[model samples]
Target: MTSVVPVLNDSMVAGYLERFITEELHSSGFTEASIAVSGGLDSAVVLKLACDALGTAHVHPVFLPYKASSEESRRDAGAIVSACGLAWTELDITAMADAYVALEPGIDRLRTGNLLARLRMAVIFDQSKKEHSLVIGTSNKSELLVGYSTWYGDMACAMMPIGDLYKTQVRSLAAFMGVPQQIIEKPPSADLWTGQTDEAEIGVTYDTLDQVLFLLVDQRLSPEEVAQQGFEAGVVRAVERKIVSSQFKRVLPPIAKTSQRTVATDFLYPRDWCT
Candidate 1:
């Protein structure tokens, strides 16, 4: 399934997110922000957006590498920092991740990859605590809807600015922002274990899935309408099913009727109320 994404030349995604960063910093009363970058399109976009929004001086990129991870990850992560002149540091999780798998025998390498993700998040949270900054999250809409990420690992962030974009849109925006084409085009992997491709794990190309998602989710098109637009109904149904089944990931915990003014549901604030 192909798509017809018009070349995006202008948007405030960069500027808006920048403004958001500044506001969050001021309101949250923090001085800096930290993010975990894997040298993939998603994190590259996040890092670049962070640098643009907060200035490279205020954005810190932390790269966590495990033994089975690619050497290219560290190299390219440096490339991103040097390109943007952002501050960065590398942490090798080889020892820590190995110790985890050693105790939990029969855990597959992919599971180990997820553990590595949480380990990195622990480090990010620790750094945020030290720097007195917020930890930024990088999960795109495509990954979030499909439950493609570990819950408390990559999904955990003090605030997320890119959760609305689909994977295809993320890459498109990355190109608009002049993110390295090599990183943009690289096969997305958690780099947890050898030869792990997101598409290979999910069984559908992001391009194909996002197109179907736009029809089903954004436009509210019926499954037949989606299929009419050159996609399989099965694909549409599958993605929709996954979206429905994984609704918990996209939302805060359900509000129970404990009180008249509960937090997530009954006590939400309206837009502009804070200002």
Candidate 2:
């Protein structure tokens, strides 16, 4: 069995950005694209893409940090913004999470993390509304598949350029686009908890996970075929289980049975009525 690491070549990245800003940005009547810039590789790549797509002037990077999130993340987030010569602002969400936690002391850190994710989106969406822009998403396909992201939290977006790429592919594109090597090499995380790493939580490396996902999702491999491709049986089982259990996260909430063509969202919309 062979392992193929997925990649989005430099030209593909550039083309996506070009397609995004020209087709989405200008068409949306947005003067800017607002991003919730986390101090992580995914967001960094999104930022770089935004810069290339819309220029620094039209790409606004907003950093929203929770109290428990590391200061290193904060610094890293700011540094990338500065390095790219783009404008950014800080919105400390410590108070917001604290207020929610105060109301429900039993709330777990995951809850707070989701809250932070939603809050950041709220900020980005609001800014997009004000600036006549749209909220760009940073979620890669790897995270999206396993429901690793917040529901309406990090998942909210006017468009996602990298959501189709695996985590490894995201790194490839970011590196090719001249993103800092530090960012490209950093351990991936959602920064939901102190000392949290994505692989540690997910129990599998992105390389392995991406291979499984690509085989399963793209190639439509069966469980047996997937396991035969060099993945641990347990890893394949776990990934399959997560995918089944988390289908709701990837889609709209279940609506009650209704008459035909009910607007409970039987419609598949591209989010815009285009020209």
Top of the candidates by TM-score = 2
Off by over 4 Å in 1: 1-11, 269-275
Regions of candidate 2 where Cα sits further than 4 Å from its true position: 264-270
For each candidate in turn, the TM-score is 0.91, 0.93
TM-score result, candidate 1: 0.91
Q: Give the number of the best model, judged by lDDT.
A: 2
Q: What is the lDDT of candidate 1?
A: 0.80
What lDDT does candidate 1 reach at residue 39?
81
Candidate 2, residues 1-275: lDDT per residue as tens digits? 34575555678667766677557777767768888988899899888888877788888888988877887788778778987898787888888768878999789877778888888888888877877778889999899999898899899998888888899888878778777777788898888888999999999999899999998899999988988877788999899998888899887677775766645466555656676
Query: What lDDT is reached at residue 251 by model 2?
Result: 74
Q: Report residue 229 deviation for candidate 1 (angstroms).
A: 1.7
